[model samples]
Target: MGDGIVVGLGPVEVEAYIDFACPFCRQFELMAGPTLDRLLEDQLITFVRHPMDFLDAVSTTGYSTRAAAAAAAASDAGMFHEYARTLFANQPPEGGPGLTDGQLVQLGQEIGITGEQFPETVRRGTYLPWPPFVTQRAIGRGIGGTPSVFVDGVAIPARPGPILTAVQAAIDGAV
Candidate 1:
């Protein structure tokens, strides 16, 4: 894979740094999903979604880390984008209990990742330590917030229009 969960075959590389419990990231997902999906389908850019865990402490059960770990599990099962989009659509409020492991497994199952390993991996939080490394990687690159977007190594606004515009600009050699 290119970096995180690589999702397209395009010349430009786009990195989406997100936290499961971050409402802004959820909003970004809601707004940008269609546009990003179009871009990915058109092979305009390679989308690598880097799920992080900065908001784990906000939830009663460390939902951020759990969710990120589950996302890693989904990625391994070839369901990262679908499962993550579903999670975003059903996202629980920040500072709340968030989704339980069972709920996460249910969501994964809804997306067709129903293998026993998926649920077991989610419950075990096997990928718990991965988010910290992803966070540190983002931090090393000066990205400290959720919904941070990068196009070909350049930081771009997280909004849908700006993200698409930046992708186009990168493609046109304008940015």
Candidate 2:
């Protein structure tokens, strides 16, 4: 759970604990991703995503775990941002079979995660244990749900506007 999949090299830290199978997490991503991207580009904040499998029981096929594991593999391939965006954009509903391993591989490929490494990692469940470990750590830290956001170690409401305001405040305070 230390540092998760980090992006950017800014002084401020923005951490998000998300579950792939959670609809609210998808909404948070869709609503706040662009703003976060802008912040990253501007080097205002270092975004750290903690992909978890907290919603695995909600998915009949354990989509949460599978998706999170795939995301970990994508992170290893240095394609985490693209793969995460793609996952949220094409998120599967809860209580149903999520994308199969092959479909996951295809999605990774569609996002330009080239080569057999990603696919083999996905199919082999190479990072399968990671999501659950993250989820447990999150729970241990009293994080009760998906889309939990933190700015400089303080929790913030997981909304686009609030998150933006908080990030801006952190930036202002840092300066």
Candidate 3:
């Protein structure tokens, strides 16, 4: 219900908990995108992305929440995947001032998410409150870190092989 993206239509669901400021999450996202995209195209699974903001302190400018909120805005605009990938590709180093609200809006535009509403949403932190709730939910589920992925409620490694294998297993078992 918060700032997450849900795609795909296969028999199983993959829930990915991630933090924008985490490099490991970025790496996993990049590695997993193509495989997931293929599955989505085939309607073989449902991918749910849960964005977290545990690394807010790492960025001098509070980029974690900002980015998460921007993502929610993108989701509303139907551009979650593109916006998220762009953010990961342009991820700023931790401990530095992350991208500004303006930059986030610009990125959205670059990815075809337009209108004043998107930028205004990013600027206003509309979805800022969502990440903590998401983090709490993850913690309640015994997940302590980013890049946590689940297939049919079973924890799977962030690596491509394990994730794909688990998803395939879920698909095969369903059929």
Candidate 4:
């Protein structure tokens, strides 16, 4: 979450880049998000979200690109954050049920987005496309794997505590 969305807190900035279908992304949400949320509420930093869904190849839920497209469509319908929360809460694991378009829409419905056009939007590729300029740019910057996250344009190391520490440290440095 970058330029399209920016939530402010304090002097630091915490931006999250993730794919809905990536297990690691889900894990990050369950883990780092809370910390980021706290940082956000304290106005200690700004939170940005760059949602990506191209990890379709490892999907057991279907294809992430489709899910991502669906999420984007949901976003277009002004249900982006809600859809994101739903998607992560019901993640099927990496290389598992990643999220079929229909399911994505169904989840949306479960979460208050009642329009039936949601799934159809994905099927029709109505939202942002994969290989999206932003996604490609992120990948080009070295995001070959799922949960490939960067804080303030710097790639973060993978271990959880260390990564969290690094992110907070980055934010601290910014302040």
C-alpha RMSD for every candidate: 1.4, 1.5, 1.5, 3.6
Can you write out model 2's per-residue Cα lDDT over 1-175, one digit (the tens) per residue? 2527898999888999998888999999999999999989999888999998877887777899899889988988899988999999999887788889899999999989998899999999998888888888888889998899999989999887877888788878952
Please say which candidate is ahead in TM-score: 1 or 2: 2
Per-residue lDDT value at 61 in model 4: 43
What is the lDDT of every predicted structure here?
A: 0.88, 0.88, 0.86, 0.66
**In candidate 3, what residue range of length 10 has the lowest lDDT sum?**
1-10
TM-scores for the candidates = 0.94, 0.95, 0.95, 0.72
- Root-mean-square deviation of candidate 1: 1.4
Stretch of 10 with least lDDT, candidate 1 = 1-10
Q: Candidate 1, 74: how far from true, in Å?
A: 0.6
After TM-score superposition, what is the CA distance of residue 97 in candidate 1 from its true location, in Å?
1.9
Global Cα lDDT for candidate 4: 0.66
- Show model 4 residue runs off by greater than 4 Å: 1-11, 60-62, 115-120, 128-132, 158-175
lDDT of 4 by residue, 81-165 (tens): 6677678899776677665666777888888876657767776777555426557766676667656655566666543575457
Clashing pairs in 2: none
Q: How accurate is candidate 2 locally (lDDT)?
A: 0.88
* lDDT: the better of candidates 2 and 4: 2
lDDT of 1 by residue, 42-120 (tens): 9998999988888977788888888888998998898899988998999998899899899999999988996699998
